[model samples]
Target: MLAETARPTAAPPTPPRLGFLRGWDTAIIAAVLVSILVASLTVEGFASPRNTGFLLIDMIPILLLALPMTLIILTGEIDLSVASIAGFISCLFGALWSSGLPLETIIPLCLLLGAVSGAVNGFLVSVVGLPSLAVTIGTLALYRGLAFVVLGDQAVTSFPRAITTALQAKIGATGIPVWIIPVLLLALVFGVVLHFTGFGRSLFAIGYSEDAARFAGITVARTKFWLFVASGAIAALVGIWWTLRYGSARGDNATGLELSVIAAVLLGGVSIFGGKGNLPGVIAGVALLAILRNALQLASVPEDTLSMLTGGLLIAAVVAPNAIVWGRTLRRKPHTT
Candidate 1:
């Protein structure tokens, strides 16, 4: 006698819970609020639309680079060569156009060059199994040196007037500069990718543990390689913007900018060692730095003091979180009887 089997019911799937904020995001948000308050209080002309427009315009490149910088850090890699890549691409675009290459041709070629640089860095790190720190540091020098080799002491100033005017022009209605449009667009795109996409989740997983992530079917090497490529491409785009805005390209332009880029990324909340951070935090970090710089300039603060302030902020950003993490770990230990 075959008895009818009892019907089985499946348990309902659990809803996802809200995740708590990471250290970097919290710090950046707080810093941003404080910066706004301080700027408003200290600088008489600080809250004007013109100053705000200038601040936003100046922030575009730094904010743009910080987007990919956040991703790279999240995936547990670093690219110290970004500033150099920017300089090199700037030189390449300028040299090509100066030598009579069409703007359309030079632009695509510059982007391709940046992508190749990133691919090489990715290969060195992933295929050759070199540490990112060592590889990027070496490439940083090599790329910047190549920039010098390409342009030497010469600068390129002659560019299409239309391109320059379009990029640097301010909008009449809001008084916001056109240069800031790219920054806003890229930031929105990256924010969506990081927070709302499966790829973003994969990045966090890979950042946590590459071997474990691979076991879970994530493409660690490929994703990381593409990450570097994207970073290179973005850096190149930043170079193009700089050339258009300044109407010139020099091998030394944006030199030592890597520090600020990293500083902005780290300050935004992504851990230096990897595995935690988000775009909102990074945007806040960028805003905070930009506002501080803008306000200080208005206050007539010395440039040297500003440099020192930034250095101190970077050090504190790196050190404070580690100290807190360690403190919590120690506190959780049970006392010996």
Candidate 2:
């Protein structure tokens, strides 16, 4: 007898899930809104378009540097020398300008110097198998010292008018600085590269587990080496832009900004341990910090106080996720015996 087969029951469908805007992104959004509100309330001209233009101008350098720094950190490595490298490039541009090097040559030279510096860092970390922290920290002083040696307390004020004006000008009378365009452009490119490319996946994998990435047939060293180079090149580009905008290039420009760049990268949800983060978060983090600083400045806060506040914010951003995870584990009741 042909027995009627029982109809198989279908598995229950998974519940609809909230998408990628997780805790970190949420925090970034909240921070942005709060900073704007606070600025509006606390300072008379804080919300004015002119003040915003200045803020945007100031943010461009940091934002641009943070892009590749985000990627490098996502691969579980750090580039502490970005600021120093930028300083060096700024001085290089200035020195060359004074020496009558054509602007074209000066531009490429700045980028080339950055690439060489980054390549050295990459070799140290990838080939020599040194710790990134140690290597970059050493390069930090080395690069900055090189800057001082090149410029030696001097400033360069003469640059091509075209370059300087492009950096300093407002965009279409909107009070949005022209420099903001490049930051936004770079952010878009970073987002695309990280989210839509095989190389990006490889980077994230390496950050998560270096051995695993190697076993999976990824060229760990080469990828990481290139990341540093990219960081250096990008930093140089930002440096040129910054020097142009400011109309002066000195060896000491952007000193102590390594902390802010790293802070912004970390605040964007890229873990110190690596294997987590994205371009969007990094961009938001940059914006949040810029807005916060601008707001605080408008309130006439002391520079030391602002530094303290930024440090605290960095610490909290790094700590909050761990605390939340711990709390979740603690509150989760044991299954019934």
Clashing pairs in 1: 24-269
Q: Please write out the lDDT profile of model 1 over residues 274-304, one tens digit for every residue.
A: 6667788778878888888899999999989
TM accuracy, model 1: 0.90
lDDT of each: 0.80, 0.81
The TM-score leader among the candidates is 2
* TM-score versus the correct structure, for each prediction: 0.90, 0.91
Residue 217, candidate 1: how far off, in angstroms? 1.3
Model 2: per-residue lDDT, tens digit, 1-337?
0112222233212211221387777788688888788778877898888898988888888888898888888777888999999999999889998999888888998999899989999999889988888999999999999999999998999776877777778877678987677679878888877877777777777777776677878899999899999989988887787788878999988887888888887888777776667777777888898898888888888999989978987897789866876789988968777
lDDT value, candidate 2, whole model:
0.81
